[model samples]
Target: MDKKNLKDESILNHDDYKDQHGAVVPPLYQNSLFTFDSWDSIDQAFDHKTEAFIYSRILNPTVKVAEDKIAALCRGEKAKLCASGIAAITSAILHCVRAGDHIVTIKNIYGPTNKFINSYLKTKFNISSTFVDGRDVAEFENAIQENTTLIYLESPASLTMELQDLKAIAQLAQSRNIKTVIDNTWASPIFQKPLTMGIDIEVHSASKYLGGHSDVVAGVIISNKEILDSILMAEHELLGAKMAPFEGWLILRSLRTLPIRMRALMDNTMAVAKFLENDERVGKVNYPGLESFEQYDLGQNQMTGYGCLLSFELLTKDIEKIKQFVDSLQLFSLGVSWGGHDSLVYAPIISYLKELSPEQFDAMGINASLIRISVGLEHTDDLVADLHQALSRIA
Candidate 1:
């Protein structure tokens, strides 16, 4: 069946095994191991010839259901559930890049991801990477070397909200036989599908939109069977970063409401973005929905909806003034992370990188006046009103 039908017909509507009570929701199979009827049955399962659970580390019925749902959502042949988004990203890269291999990445990727490749991976595995401004696909091509094994990117990058051309980059990677992976957390499958543009693999922090409520912390790596097997065989089993059964169940439950939640959040976000754009205190708004945005045409072409997350730089790069603005907001909470029912506001503090000097901060796009706001499910009028009061106090 086609992907949309697979999602709507089987994956979305499908239910896990239930007890005699006929409970609709899947119960958490939280056991570490399952008992086998016989040695023959165990042997068959070990040989991959039967559908039986040997151990939770290797497989769990609940986790498998969630993996299948996300795999379908990503339009990949297979998917693997991981303890966290970083685990998925780490495993995916490690599985492909051996010692002496190289990777090219967009500069504005998540801070931890940058650390992993540049610092952690380099020290431990002798792997090296080049960071480039991925807004220009040529930068990726220019950075590629003989040993370049992978290209990693996060479009509409988390803090900067910069959009990358997935199709162009995927095609370039294809010619060089290099694998491509994207952190699709910002624009969930509801907004963008990387696989359709020929990306080799897709990764997500299910902790964000996929989990929806910010209650669960999980990650997913979706790819074809070949890459999935190599990853699972190489590090997935040995590293033991698998998601728990109950966490997987929670993600499955979250999937049903993803479309609805995303729609509401986008509606709220569009209104808020417009409010910020019109405000004189806000010097610049970085939302794809805004007509004045640099990549507005590309966003309209590639994304289904302008995502709920956006960033803005204030007219005055005053730290105390920015903090006061954020603090005065009664509706928005000052915290980390997004894709929750409650709105969050993050100032351009040093929470991203500890040793990042003032020079480094200037090198990156962030400044003291810049702040990232994640629009939640709150009413648009209330959110706008709160933002108005906060900005009014700034002057």
Candidate 2:
């Protein structure tokens, strides 16, 4: 199949499944080790003279199929499936930096990822990172140092949904010979193509949209063969964070329906976002799909669609009212981690108030009354009604 010419939906269905007795879906290879025919064959496999799957830790047929599909989806030369989103992220970061290296990243990054860069990397490897507001390309430019080796980004970042100029930052990083990596979980491959926009590496939390269901927790890294191979051979193998065959199979099953799910999610989310934007109870709706959003144009330039995840600030900052509103919602379940079949509502104030100081919360742009909604496959009218009822309680 000519993947370059295939549409996003078609690409998901173009997998080669000829080897499993004409089965439409690829069969799972759940074995931990593949037996070698002879010592000669084993030697050849070890020497890289012949293609083989020696151990599940290094590679597996089931996982390889998923990796190939993800790579094709992202328009990348190769891909690696890791145990979790953080595994993929940390492995990719390890490949790009050494001791004494520096990284420039956005302040509103994923919580655990921010911790990994700020705490773990600094403490263990002597690596340093500068957190910057990524809306302005000048912020990234100003943060670069002589030791800077990587620029990390999460466009339409975590809570506030602020976007970065991917093309501009990619150009800037390229000019300075610095590598670029992005967490493409929000857009998935269906909505955005970061690699084509000059990003050196693209990472996804396959636990989210790619899986389309909450049943799996996995992640993937997509890049050209050279960078992928380096990470695969070194950090990935050493960390022993390969995805299980069962999880790989689950992601493959999800990919078959990703295009349809994403479309429904976009439609449903837009409806909810518009409702929130017009409601007097809402202070601001941080979603790229909203024309009023500050970075809507930038988002339109880089992304084909605004994803399901969005956050809104309530008109009131009262903690009890925020709790009352969240507790009053009937359809949207309170939870963390989005991109599933059920709508989820997350209140940062409820979860982080005790853990984070007022200054830290301000720095991350997470307001005390902010509520994040992850629109799911529910009917749009029902979701809107749920919000309307919930807002009435707060009023």
Candidate 3:
């Protein structure tokens, strides 16, 4: 099948399941290893003379189906599925650098990812990194050193929802021979295609939007075959973070409804963002969909749709007031992580007050009163009412 000619919905729903005995869904191959009928078959599999699954950790029929679907959706040559989002992220990062290599990354990247680059790689691998604001392509360009081998990014970054100019940065990185990797978890393949914009690799925490029900924890790395082949042998297989068959099946199920869910979430979130923006008690709404956003034009150019995740600052900077507003929201469950069916609220101050220095907080535009919301599949009126009543508490 020519995936390039198909729409995302078609790719997600039907791309990899056609050969599965007319089954509506792909069947899960739950075993740990595939046995060969003859010694010659085993030798052929080992030598890559024939396509065969030898071990579950290396490859599984079920996981490959999910990988193929995601790769097609992202318009990438191949994909590697991992046990968790961090696994995919770390694997991709590892594949791009060696000892003494430097990385330029966004200041407000995902928390675990920030830690991995700043702490783990720095202390263990002798690797170094610089954090850029990511709003300006020049920030990335200025950070590149002779040793810089990778430029990592998270557009609509973490809490502040800041965006990077993907095309500009990609061009900059390519010119400098630096690999560009973007965490596309916020947009998913449905909204953004970083690969199409010349990014070297696209990473996702499938636990978020891809596993929309929040039941599965998985991650995927999408890129050309050459890059993925190297990672598949080195960081992916050697690191032993392959996605399980059951988890792959769950991700496949979620793919079927991805387009529908994303569109609905976008609509619901836009309504919620507008409500907060108009409310007197809300300080600044940090959703890219809002015209008032600083990077609204850039977001429109790069992304097809603004996603469900958004953050807003309360008019007051008091922690107590922020807590009251958050606690008042009966519909939004206070927690970390977003992009699921249930609405969630996370207060960065509650968790990061002690974890981050004052300068770090300033750099990321995070504050005590900032509240992040992940809008779900609920009716727009109910979500708006929930926000209305929650804002009333702060008022």
lDDT of each: 0.85, 0.90, 0.90
Per-residue C-alpha lDDT of model 3 across residues 48-147, encoded as one tens digit per residue: 7213699989889898998988998999999988999999999999999999999999888998999999999999999999998888888888999999
Name the Cα RMSD for model 3.
1.6
* Tens digits of lDDT, candidate 1, 1-395: 44356653356666655767898887778989988888888888888722357888767888988887788777788898999999999998887788999999988899889999999999998999999988888899999999999999898898888888999999999999999999988988878889999999899888888888889989999999888877876678889899999899899888888888889999999999998999887888888888899988888887888667889988886677877888999998998888878888987664744567766788786765778899999899999999999989988
lDDT of 2 by residue, 91-117 (tens): 998889999999999988998899999
Candidate 3 lDDT at 120 equals 96
Off by over 4 Å in 3: 1-4, 15-21, 49-51, 357-364
* Per-prediction backbone clash count: 0, 0, 0
- Name the lDDT of candidate 1: 0.85
Better of 2 and 3 by lDDT: 2
Ranking by lDDT: 2, 3, 1
Q: After superposition, how far is residue 316 of candidate 2 from its true place, in Å?
A: 1.0
Clashing pairs in 1: none
lDDT of model 1 at position 243: 93
- TM-scores, one per candidate: 0.95, 0.97, 0.97
